[model samples]
Target: MVSFGMKDLLTLPITIVTGVYTALKFIYHCFLRPLQSGNSQKTRLDQASLFYEGQAGIYDATRGGLLRGRHTMLALSASHLRILRETAANKRLVWVDIGGGTGHNIEFMDDHFPVSSFDAIYIVDICEPLLQVARDRIAKRGWKNVTVLCQDATVFWLPEWLDGIDPRGSVSFVTMSYSITMIPRFHAVLDRVEHVLAHETGLFGVADFYTAEKQESLIDRSIGGLDKGCGWFRRWFWRIFFEFDHIFLGSARRSYLEHRFGTIKSLNGRNHFLVPYLVQIPYYIWLGRSRFRDNYPLDRSLELEYVSQESPGIPVEDVPLTPFHYSITKHWRVPYFLEPTHEKFHSFTRVFTPEDSMELIRHLEVSRDDSVLFVTSAGDSALHLAINSRPKQIHCVDPNPIQGHLLELKLAAIQSLEYEDFFALFGEGKHPTFRSLLDSRIAPYLSAAAYQFWKRDKNNFSSSFYLDGSAGQALAFMRSIFGVAGLSKDVIAFCNSDTLVEQQPIWQRKIRPVMCPTIAFLLRFGWRVFGIPPNQWKMLLKDGDVSAYVRDTLDPLISKYLLKTESHFFHLALTGHYTPQCCPEYLTRAGFERLRTNKGEATDAIRLHTKSMLSALRSLPASSLTHIVLMDHFDSSETRGS
Candidate 1:
């Protein structure tokens, strides 16, 4: 029987067909569509391995939300077992928060659940910078039970870390708080947790935006928001500009990275080799989220939209002014600021105080053509720019609404709540505080977390202390909060980020000793440069030993705060226009302003004109107006953060 053998199966016709299909596909990809894929680059199967190493740098700054809430979640989930100092013995509770950046959760646990006894905390993450920060933070806290490591939850699971340095069956609770979503293949992490969990009795929780396809489409659409109205020119320019990141992380060191850290596990949706990473840019952009544009406008707009829709009884026009409207949670993060900044160059030398704003505004005058934007000008800084503009179309955006609203309320309560009233509101100290009025005023609006942290002491220090969470500046608040219980500034500073500890929370400790030098160097450099004055190096990692990698990454602050504008980037963030893409002040550079008549896309409008020489000259028009302030379209798009 002449059976079709291997050679016979390779018929000329079949071979030709295969060749034609392959050739056509190649042609289409090469000629028809644009292809900037990095398919040739090494595939990343063990993503955590690469990412865990990078955490030492990205920690704290990039981690979504502060580490405050995560601890509460863990403590709440604790199975009635006393953590750390249990009343009964042998009922040891364990926790593993995968992808937990910086191990702040551990301190949270240590702070609140001190009554209970814990065996260990396993913090897992893929970025070394973050892990290092986590380690440094744990060390400062003086936590003894916590442990951290930097291994991919997929492909390789460290049994010793999971079980114990002494015993193997001492596991308890496992959590994933917004960390797993950043991972490509989080299943491995989940599976390892399941496998090592203290059986079915072990507690498992995930405080993540667990979107099941429906949420995915919502996420995708939200991400695609960056594409809408981006215009071809801006889109193309950004596509290339963002690609530099791909070259640095993937293209340049593809092989060496793979050999050194194994490989990233999840490369899903990789339409382009660089697509996986590049896609974030468009998503970032389209959400109308510019680092320059404060998110209050978009966030508040959406919330208002939801409120307006859900409560048909309410009119859209009434939403802004209606007392009932503010009572509702609708429109949480709207574009409250008129214009914002979006320059990568701005983050370094950001406008820090109200004085900075005035410095820049001195050179100009505002007229009909000029739409002036104040980074934040309703309260303290507002006092600076208020006189500058005649009609006053100033807009305000701050993150801590409790704090901001308190400021707004202060005026209404002015004479009614005078002198000591101000101190009583925020003046718990032996001396009078500048924020005395606000402290008394914002008492009702404290967040559950803020309240929880503040509850330990009955001497309510006032709103200014709790309002210390100035965007990119949290040290003051930490100091204030710590001071309430008699913690000294030096001890607080040391405890805030002591890098001397040997072990870390599960979120940090990614290094294997070999990477220590590089880690220390970078830490030192980042603390010295990017760490800023108020934030201090210790705030990031509490480390005395700085690494070379961290040191080299430090760059000078690029954004300048004008003493003239009565607006500063810090104030803008306080007002709520904080994002990485742009700063509100950047729009001022383009000659735009904030006025009652002013509406929509300040930075973008100016950017379009700036691209053209004659048009930009025509747009501003030789002092047709007196002063020009720049702040528009700086905040980037935010994913549907459900």
Candidate 2:
């Protein structure tokens, strides 16, 4: 047994008292303290200085849990700077951090980007205490290139401007982390920001508290149709709660920011670390470029010529540009169709292709010079073509915008994810940290509409990305039927079989008798779940009855190919997931490695078009495409006279 002495008996009580005192001190400084008790006429600077005078020592320690998305904002800004620097390598890069408290963002940014790479950096703030702490940090870190300016953001200027050097349109980057809400004249500061940023290459990044409602009509077309709305209760509650601290959480700030800049990427997240209550606070991170039309660096004349399909002598100012022409991603996806109201297919129709991709590859004989056009059904065939042929370009056309979104998600996953994460997301059909990965890794490459769609439906991966869509529902129903009939073991065994001699008996003895009748019944009554329309069903009926059709389809597939090693389509049907040896080529290690090489040049070769196949074909130049794979679309078109 352990013995306790007088010193040990007193230690627990002393430590408990010290802990309680610290907790109360933190709570009092953060929440209970008043800014100005009796003077209501104090200026913004006076109020800010008095409020932060006592809390400056503990600000970093106490606010680390409350301030979320700061590092993410810094990371995104660093990425944009790297890309922008490549274009303007000869120019000097300048950065400005507005309302930079204690130089935390600049210090943290060194982890993502070298602070010495910039020619100059400025930290503008109004509070003296915070500026003193920032000066101390700069001295300790020995950042000779950094300067702290104890001035208001709206009237701040660089040292070169004082020497008559005219520093306007010279800054390369500007950032505000949780500081926009504290400024009384945010519009003036934003105007100042726009004036100082470089003409075409400047980048603006901001992360702050916000509240908004879901209003589709208010979405800005130039921002790629991004909607970051919260619930009604959250909108009202956070707005009222933040008023006590003189921090505004209304939507006006975001709206003004969007109006001032052309958005590149925007993400919304919740900070759930408020101790004692654990209430979620909403925050957002936004990145953008200059909004002036004249500042756009892309070739407007060439874009107009391409859109008109004429000679390259058209005057850009004479033609009115559509929203699609101003795409920041420079991809072919149309934003108007990506809206939820215009969606024809809310859920995916096919999880995997029924046509043999290897057979199609052999017959098409694709080459490096060939450009193939095909329907984007779950993106499996396109991946196969990209890996095998290494084509110059592949145009993926689909009427439903969700199908294009699905393909975009897969491409982004291929470009960013490691092989294990890629296998877990696609092969096993589920992942635990999909939302985190989606925000951090996969978001930079996707369009705003695609990012928003996945952000809203990220829970699909939490259960099973392959078990939530319409086709997956059908598979789920079939799985339930197999479970009821005690055929689950045989289904597993059929997928695990080594040879045709072993697979045929299990199929004939256990699965075939139950599967054929069910498929026949579903074909007659409920075939839409299988993505077969009335016209396609009529085309199928022209050959034979439903029972004979089902028998013919299953017998030929099972007789010709082994289920375990040869056919991944049927294996997925019997079992809801795929194994390493029996899966799509893109999901295999060798295929993934091939696509991952050369910084994802193969994935970049594919362009997505969200429109009808006819419209997509009409837009392309004649004789430009070498191969066109219609799959079963020809049958549907002939039946409908399209």
Candidate 3:
């Protein structure tokens, strides 16, 4: 203070400026720079440590703003832990938190589930600085149970690190809180976690960012719609954007977890009000239990055998978790497809028999004693078999309740309505008095559920009921295209052509040229509208080219069966009506007599089912049916892997 030179006086201002500049740079890199993209100068682990080391003092404060769903995840974890604790009160409860940086997630959960709930809490991280910060936070909280250890989460099970904990899957709960995406070998880490988790008591909780690719099937799309996925473009954009920060947002992480465990609670949420790029960061919170359970045994052979013997006649509610039930419920809380609002939208209004029922009967050597399992789609093929082959029993099955309802309605109509009314409704594809008939004649024979379903949609019968359901959409689309291309007249001419030879030429020359290319394009890009899911479309083209499959295979087949024969199906496609000479067996005079005269026998012989084909088969005693008709069940291109 007493002695000052000219150089000393100059250094004071420079020192102050330098300190302020360094502070500004530190703040920018810790906060603002993370939000922006940049090339990484170090390894991923080193880079993560560097960012955390610099921001550790402000980590908890800064994270609360940008990171979302922490509270929700903690609540979910606490709920699961509470459930597990009831059963394992006497056992030593160990919770392992992999990559638990700063001990924040654990400390936050303490208020919810009490730190004393667990016998031991292992907070594992590779970064010593982050672990040091976690130790300080835990120490301040005075949680004697929590132990902070600096170790690689992916390889923490080394002999030196296993301090007397049971080696054979003794961990009760494991959590990875927004940390997996940063680890380079995350799969390896997950694999290790799965092994360490208690076989019967383990619960895993995770909350992290993820991006889902576009689903290729209608079922998949419906699922995605329920899941709240940001559409394909946004998902891809976010995935790439987050990858720059060594934060992976791929589907693999979530899918792997799902494969390893049974989901208990899962939710996908987006946080807004941040900057534009960070606004829609997709984070998911998931709670899952290990697939292994003490209450239920893994072996399903006994259950399968039981179902194989006694499923057919058992009440649907009484049937246990068969393969079919598992398929229907695995992805959704409820059967969304079977809900009344969605049911009618996807129903098949008219029967379009692509395969010749008479030919199938001949090939299979139809006999009076044979029992048949028929797929109930518009009830055309089953009715054909009933009339022509007259098999002893026909088990009509369809997973779609709407399709079964349609078949039931047809059966009720056959039992009650006279020949002319049946012909007008089905053969001609129109019935102005359908609602009157349904209430007066058809409703009496229908099941209570079916009756209710029809009563709600009685308006559908007033107009062209044949053109209302999803099956008619393809025909409607075709008609629109024909109108656009000026081929309506040509289509009529082809349908009107008398001889089989003349019909093929008319189809080849006029119809094929116009419709084939358009159909191919639609099949490739817009098959979903036609009720052809991507998986089903892939199955269609599994053997060869789509266009060639249509041209060489489908065209010839159609020419032989539909164009040449009295195939009312093609007539409906062309004119939306069926003539007397070209109609299903149910519309024929002799067939109608058999159904009308013997209503009880007809009803008894044809057992209509509104459940999955496999499930229906399982319900019935094994060897109950001599013949099985899968129909278009195998149309899906995507298999189990897809």
Candidate 4:
């Protein structure tokens, strides 16, 4: 009615556009623009607080899967604490969870570590909104032990934060969960943590995003696995991607931490953002003690008892006491067990053998009456022979005392536990209550050295204890390699394949390409951690192409034996454990009974020696041995011993 002109209609369209733009601007100002406004001029704490102001409500929901390794880090820390708590009577546990937004990590960790067990839990963060969320979560649980403080992590004084509960710099555990990447002064924060934990036997743990520089030296790169750093592309792409949201993914954060502490354990894992276009993010969880020897010092007396044998001068108890008992006894004056020492013989750290026991048995053609003297790589081959072939007597010996301990545990488990429990302990490769089981049942049958070794490593059972030794590490490395090549599914399928025919196609199609020259180079270098000594590697490459040797050696093992479901070694490598139907012969019920009881229904056939094979053999009478499975003994030997 006012005007019937084209100009008026065009003006209406302009007005509509103006209204939409205003609405969008208002929304951005209210929510998103503030997140991007915290510039370099502002204090880091203020910036963090401003960023998290509106985020705390949705923090847990947003970060549930984006943040990884919370459970694993907590579990490892708690296991470490279990050992400390048992030793310390008067010491009260103190925990300081840095940047514990919304109290989600603590709540998640509650399964592994009881929140109330700590005398105090100080949730420290600069954001009051986040702290309030933590405060509310703690309050709802009616937990009196937890206290939330909105303080700068870089300079927060522990004594003041604790309200004078304890003097300054006294805390047992200081953990940073997914917060180190957000700190502007992370180096200063780490310095503060190192200071706060100065007085106590503390563990400083952190899980955060990081990018590691690529190595120019292939040799160095090969040895530097996930525990060290990432590749060139991952380091660059992730650094830029995370830096956009005010998060830093520099290598300095992790390098500085390692320089400040004695590394106990560190693991790198990838967390996928689950969004369309976002790539997988690499994060690492590290646990360490202070650089000083105050925390968990190497107990000289305990080491002596575990590594030493009963010599003539030392008063040997009729039944060897646990290492804990020896620690309390303080027998520093006891003479160290005398064994002729050689560097080459003592270099191996693996308590278990990587060789396939079934293959060894098949190739050796061992008889029922064979008297076997094996090098005792884990004593698994000996046990297999004993159970399958019913060997007359088996002598398992090693220079490293730890290997003897593993054999002793296996024997004790066979003797005391049911088939199911034994399978769980050794076959499935883990048993949560291994310590309790060892104390109540297995320890009585073990020697002083063997008892102490297993006692020290009792916590290994908390996870896959089978994965603790070098053989496990090799399998783990293989699994990691497969995962990188996106062949994990193919590996699972191959491992689960019932017949050779079923697995051949899968291997050729999906797995063969992963064995490229690059993988071969990396694996050859990584063999060091997998228990292949430098000299042994040289011996393997003496006559043939290294890549061909590796491929020929592994192809049949993986495709034929593993796919046929006859090789538990590869099965365990592919999957963390073995099914009852697919485990080792010694792990089966019939095999367990046969080993536990001989044709005469007795259980004293297997023997373990903690001394060198030469010492053990010299002590035995001549013409006493039949089958000697040296496990490449001459390959590593410098000279013949009497």
Clashes of each: 156, 0, 6, 0
Query: How big is the positional error of residue 2 in model 1, measured in Å on the Cα after superposition?
Result: 96
- Candidate 4: tens digits of C-alpha lDDT, residues 247-349: 8988777767765655555566667766634566888766666654432323345333542543434443222222222221111111123233522343236
RMSD after CA superposition, every candidate:
26.3, 5.8, 20.0, 15.2
Residue lDDT tens for model 1, 231-257: 355445544553432311111121111
Cα lDDT over the full model 3: 0.66
Per-candidate Cα lDDT values, in order, are: 0.36, 0.78, 0.66, 0.65
Which parts of model 1 are misplaced by more than 4 Å? 1-58, 61-72, 79-91, 155-170, 213-642
Which predicted model would earn the best lDDT? 2
Which residue pairs does candidate 3 place in steric collision? 311-619, 312-619, 312-620, 535-637, 536-636, 539-637
Task: After superposing candidate 4 on the true structure, give the runs of residues whose Cα lies further than 4 Å from its correct spot.
Answer: 1-43, 159-169, 198-200, 215-227, 275-278, 295-378, 381-422, 428-632, 635-642
Task: Arrange candidates by TM-score, descending.
Answer: 2, 4, 3, 1
Cα lDDT of model 2 by residue, 33-145, tens digit = 87664334246678888778887877787778788888878876776677678678898888899989899988888987899999999999988898889999999999999
Return whichever of 2 and 4 wins on lDDT: 2
Global local distance difference test of model 2:
0.78
